[model samples]
Target: MLDMQRRKAMQKLALLGGGMALFPTLDAQAKMLEKDVPKWDEEYDAIVVGSGYAGTAAMLSMMDRGLKNVLMIDKMQYMGGNSSISGGSYAMSRTSIQKENGVMDDPEMHIKDTLKSGHNLNNPEMVRIMAYEGLDAFNWLVENGVKWKLFSRSGGHSAPRNHSVGVGSYITRPLQEQIIKRGGQQRTRIIMDELVYNDKGIVMGMKVREKYEFKFDRTFDENDNKTGKVKYYRANAGVIIATGGWAADPKVRQIFNPALTPDMPTTNHYGATGYTIEKLIKDDIDLIDMQYIQIMHVTSADEDSFGFGFRTITGGYSYGMMINPKTGRRFINEIADRRICSDAIFAMNEKGKNHPLLIMDVNGAKTVEIDALQRGIEAGAVYQFETLDEMITKFNVNKEAFLDELKKYNAYVKTGKDPEFGRTFFKYKDEYITIEKPPFFVTRPGPKIHHCMGGVRTTVDCEVFNKTGKIVEGLYACGEVTGGRHGYNRLGSNSVVDCIVFGRRAGFAIAERYQKMVRS
Candidate 1:
């Protein structure tokens, strides 16, 4: 019996030893203590470590490319992460919508706008791809049942190209439906503990924690987590890290940018602590653009994240304007990119002034969806008044100065020029929007950490690279988790495009590589 048991143990060891060859470098140190073969609880062709736009896109793309048995996992109990609550703005150029809307835009213009918004630090090649293929991504979503309408003008783009849904759910829900329809699997509450790399330094899979509970009350420390059951998941094709950025992790944010204090709120979800990227970095993966955290400068002051209060500001910035509470005057260009707006707001906060007042007229309010707009009003994040005088009384504005500023702003609208701040105002139905219409809307807008412009480095094909500048074979990344596309500041509405475009690339690349390997 002893001899038979020994033989069976050796046979099991022989069968499992090669599987535990993942992360050879890290395992070598552990092997010094004990040589234990990791047992895999699940196996799939592809594993996507997020459930947002990028991860969903990757799964859908993989399934579309005939790669079955793809699984998407999220640490959070609910899927969609920050994407579920996002504004659902997708920027694309040279689309049917643009042509139909008679908006003059091309790929060159899109690329130029992206680069300019990133302060010329963006990857030109990635920007080129995003611009050229944006229409395809847009069409893909539409074909996959995303009902997007109403092109709102975003701040840095020269033309109106921000195609939006009422909320982000409109985009994520339909794509999730398509993912299920295509036979992809999605599991929530599964957190990645460590990436499993084979002896050749190729990523093979991940060691994960099932039923993981994210600690939201404490500072998010990825290494100190205690909950969940340990399990290993093997991915034969590849592992795509679309785990998004570290905006919600105050500690991570302050490490890269000290100005991002702990008190500052983020638009990202609590689970967007960036543990997956942190694991990769600890395992010697290269990270880039770590200092460029982006902030949304026009969010409602009362709201914790981009929820409820955001709908009002979206329309306010598009059609109305922001004015300093004390001065009752526009400080920065209302149509400027996020960086400029955020810096201006931060400067105001430093001076001990309240968050700036964002006000829009009936014409601007027309841009907001009726239901959401009503909800914002009911939540008290948005205040509505029948007249500018009533708005002044409600918010205690400098009535005379505010009226004078509006007069000047309305003049600029009529002439299609903003000489004071160089704002590029939008024209609705051949007429530039002005705040002269009745029933004004106002919200106190402040800054919130919105996006992390820095993360793991990836090629144009979305293949993650190691610190040695060599490709970590079988490792892919896309969306906000991998940086290179946006330079210093990401343009509004561009993140959605980034996720879908690169996510599709990562998915297709993994599928093709796996198919080739099988054929070979």
Candidate 2:
């Protein structure tokens, strides 16, 4: 590995290993935060909850601005959060990355595309801020050692607006290393179970607990295996909840968006249980866009039954194409908005017993690279099939019907047009000139819980607000934890930008608030 690559790898291991910044352990770590534990909870200058893009961004900005009392806390050992597991792609306007590549992008055009992608259901002011500040935030990533490259995505973005890691890993980790260097406290395996309010009804800090969703191996005798109790965690200060959305926790989804069953697939991280969001709602923290869920139509590497959706694309032009099991026919244009894509995937399962093929050809295959694939090779996107026939046999697609479809698709390609779906030639770069690529692979795209657009609603400055629009004193929010930015749907790779731009704003807001409050 090159020097930069080595540094990045070590940093990632640190995040996974839960040690110091850039993979180093401090001579003196911050009391484990767990030490304070369920007894004698203390305070800090700033307390960040949910170490996803937003929380980590806030942590860095605060520490960089020289806040000594800042603490970066989260439930996970690694700081990447869902952003880490994500495609690591983001849409930013006026970015040096874009201008350097001569993409001819502007905030206005980006706003238009974003709104169009969201089907005109976005909050105008928030969208405007997001677009305007995105480029600067992205540049910040590059400056802080984040390696972002260009990729076109499922969004109808004009200029391949997806900026992702040039390497396979997440782009957020390097930014996280910067935060740690600045002396922000990072604690993994911590979960914020409840919000803490001060004497004046001010949303002060939060009560954190250790938590783990994975069931423990049972040690039982004369009985069936028992699930081990999960861990608990806590954090107190001005708790900025950046814990992400409800996609993974189907139970939470079914509870809130009852129309959709939890059994529906999601590409979201397992930790994306939305425990904080649910409790906050119970606290009467009114929310917006709860019905929104970002689902994908990508294949899962684990199971041969191909019904899930949500494959993270590493590069190239790709989206999703679901097939009809009965007739082996294509259904739904692949490039729809995320929410629509998700809803469509689930609808396919609901209609076809949750069995459908998410199809992409040779060029498409090259583009679909989810980083976790290598690290989790035994279970990443890995599949077992030598030929297309083997895949059909293993996956149980209608044999003759699929063969007929492929024959027709191949013939249509020779004519230089996809008559079935007007995918438009140029739209798909390096188009599927042929589907005869050996190991024409396919897998189950599990419905993943990617992100939660709803959380603590905030103004442009990232200040948390009540139903009356009054700022909750000392409380601020950023990232997937905050809502009302993208309305019914989010543009591809926009949330990373959201976390950075708004996270800085929240950090600044907190810093300014702390300085003034302390002085006065």
Candidate 3:
């Protein structure tokens, strides 16, 4: 009898559209119309709204805490979001990798570097948590089969603390495999083309439209013909919005951070828009530092190939110097923090300068991995010249001025003092690489929209707060979706650690609350 009734209700929904409607029962529909409350279609113990590093970390933590009915979803067809395409460098201190590399680093040093790089606007407690717990997160990744063998130095770090898995799939793939191994396909249901929520939000459930391509800049309009059947998902415990930031959304980027216009290309994936952030704002969640977007200090001008266009030039910059082609002078210290270098480049561009050249010698090229350098060269991003005159003629740089600058830089390299710019080398300081050795390599690189240090404000443990400065019950956030971990800028390689640390905290917090509720 119940099956018959359900079939009849499904038939009614099919009549209304192609599939399920808002409410199945006529009485429930009447109640919804009278009270104007959203009706939930399905329920789970917990619902995670992304599948990136943060979302996967949160799910793993929840599963560890004995939460079996947890559901993870994503708007994209693939599981990994921006994390899959990321450079896969994670900032972790005092890890086994650091110890094996014979580098002495600690959480205090990590926190100091992070705070300094962020210009001291970072939340101290949150920074402390991430710094202290980062090593454990690294260990977690290793224990779960993430093979990390290399440790390199990025822009703002005090030591060689950045650990890389070569590619982001090293972190994401293991987590995905673990999820499938533990719970099978049904355990992690990733729904694509689903816009999770709208204005009416306590995160009780999410309104999902199947086969719909969501527009990030605007709210959903029912009149759109391309949209598919709408469904709702309820969270019995809480909802975790681990969706990334708005780096790729030009409209939102222009509105919030006007300095980053639509003309500038982004390193983020297509799905790294502000749709979730917009929905959270409509739900009255407190947003912080929306205007503080960080641009990558170096990227290739060519868009056709992959090597240097979207790839972060951190390693290149760390091992090379940025020179203004027209003046043939080093404009900024290439080893400074990401924001400072990007700002310096922007300042040069504001003065009507050409795209700055990142020039490196053979030894400097040796500082980076050989395979990576070869890939960039093969992709036509990195140009190699046999001599100074060849480089000058090819790039149309002033011959005399360029040679003069090179002489001055070589002098500094010998003396181990960069008095002009006070540039400090994080690695390879003992054996400095001068640009005099041929063949020479150069690339015109500049900043592109990289990271947005802004989103839903949350506590140290990742519980989201409202406009009234009170915790919104049954709601949590993690990863790039929540802000305050970074302030005006993020330190190099810190994002992955921030995601893992806080994502686990959020999962544990929600699971504890749910367990307490069950006991009561």
Candidate 4:
């Protein structure tokens, strides 16, 4: 039986002192065995290697473009990957939602804000494409059954442009349904093992393992373990790599940023490893901006991972202000870029030996979803106090200093000038931006590893480039797998648009290439 052979193969690999270093031998072995092509057990018109927003978008776009036999796969048992639990906020411009909400925004402003947030290191063309085509991508999702509503503009955006579906599953689940309804096939627990390319260095297919069981103990070297049965799946058109970043793997994170030790908590799932990106690198693919791993400034100090606690941040950071419990003074600009806020919090926590408190009044708490806020309160991630005296007594803060700071902040909000930290406020009603209302809500948030802003380099069309700066034929990448979209830092809510925009573009490009090949 196939199962017996797979077990024997795994045992053989273990006997060979473990296949822990299987991928490191890729370069030398690939050259030596250049003539030996894999025997493919299955074939598809196009293959998408991930089930997150990017992969789902790619598959749907391919199907929309008349590619029927498209197949999508994920290494994990569950679909959507990291995107399933993400914040699910999409940043866009010129949307009807923004206009209805009296938010005057445009693609040009979105592009400018993105560049400023990334510190001008992002690929201008790629940013432009995402900003311009983002509306189309949003419309596509709506047409495909994603019911979106306007969320507040996240950090680093100048206008209220973030739209959401409550959570990432809302967006991913609907699109997945569309894929199944259209007869597109999706398989989970299928891990990509090796890239199968021809002699001319053109991708033909990929060697993968079906029913792959992820080992949590060896989180860093997940693919190094021999668990699943290896088989080849040929892609007639190409392989689209949508596998996400390596924020969950501490060892991999340390390779790019030594400061990101294992002690740091990450919002990513255990499956968000860099094996696919590492494999691409071994194959001489060009990887850029690997050093720019982003840390979320507003993760729950109470929760171990991503939870309802994030809703506290959605309300607190945007509508309220962060104050040091030890000093009872606002340290940095609360609504500044994520990098700025996170770094300041890191410093404050180290100095005070305590977590900073995010304080929001009733008006501010109104921004968060009611259900999520209630869940956060029940989960012990958020605390509510009817009076400032109650909060002061609970945190043992210098009550006078805290009260004085709030007064100053409210005055700045009135004048539209944050002289202390220069935090840009939302251009909405006073009650929404001011923190003067009673019945305060507070959350203790700390920085957690959130997104990796580095991976394989890609053209605007999502065509990947080799180390030699040449396009890899039949090989495309999108989502967190391909870098250079966000330069040093990625703005919040931009990841959704980035993934969908490029994923759709890559899907269309690959489908068009396939059609041209058929004609030829």
Across 73-96, the per-residue lDDT of candidate 4 in tens digits comes to 999979998899887899999988
Instruction: Kindly give the stretch of ten consecutive residues in candidate 3 with the minimal lDDT sum.
Output: 25-34
Better of 1 and 3 by lDDT: 1
User: Residue 363 in model 1: shift from native, Å?
Assistant: 2.3
lDDT of 1 by residue, 1-520 (tens): 6336434533554474311111222211221000122677889999999999999999899888989888999998888987888888899887787788888888898888888777555777888999988889899999999988667668788888888886778888898998888788999999987887766777778888899987875275866888999888889988999998888887767777777788887778788785666577677787776777898875778766776878678778878988886778888887788888888887775533577888888888877888878988887789888888887776677778888999999999889888888877777666678888788888887778889877888889989887788988888999999887887789989999999999999999999988987899
List the pairs of residues colliding in candidate 1.
22-197, 23-197
- Going through the candidates in the order shown, the clash numbers are 2, 37, 0, 0
After superposition, the stretches of candidate 1 with alpha carbons farther than 4 Å from their true spots are 1-36, 218-220, 350-352
Error of 4 at 126 (Å): 0.5
Ranking by lDDT: 4, 1, 3, 2
Q: Taking the tens digit of each residue's C-alpha lDDT, what string does model 2 give over 1-520?
A: 3335434533653564421212111122111223333543556777888777788778777766667777776665556667776666778756666676566777898888776665444667788888888777777777878876545544466566777774324566776777667766777766565565645656656555554333321111101212233332223235566677766665666555555565455555556665666566655564665655555444452543222223432221243245666567666555555555556666666643655565545544555554433332355454534577776766777888787877776676567566666653333444544466664545444445455555567878888776566777767878887877775467777877787888888877777777776788
Which ten residues in a row are the worst by lDDT in model 4? 17-26
Clashes of 2: 37
Candidate 3 Cα deviation (angstroms), residue 415: 1.5
- Quote model 4's TM-score: 0.92
State the TM-score for model 1.
0.90
Whose TM-score is greatest here? 4
In order, the Cα lDDT scores of the candidates are 0.81, 0.60, 0.73, 0.84
Q: How accurate locally is residue 180 in candidate 4, as Cα lDDT from 0 to 100?
A: 97
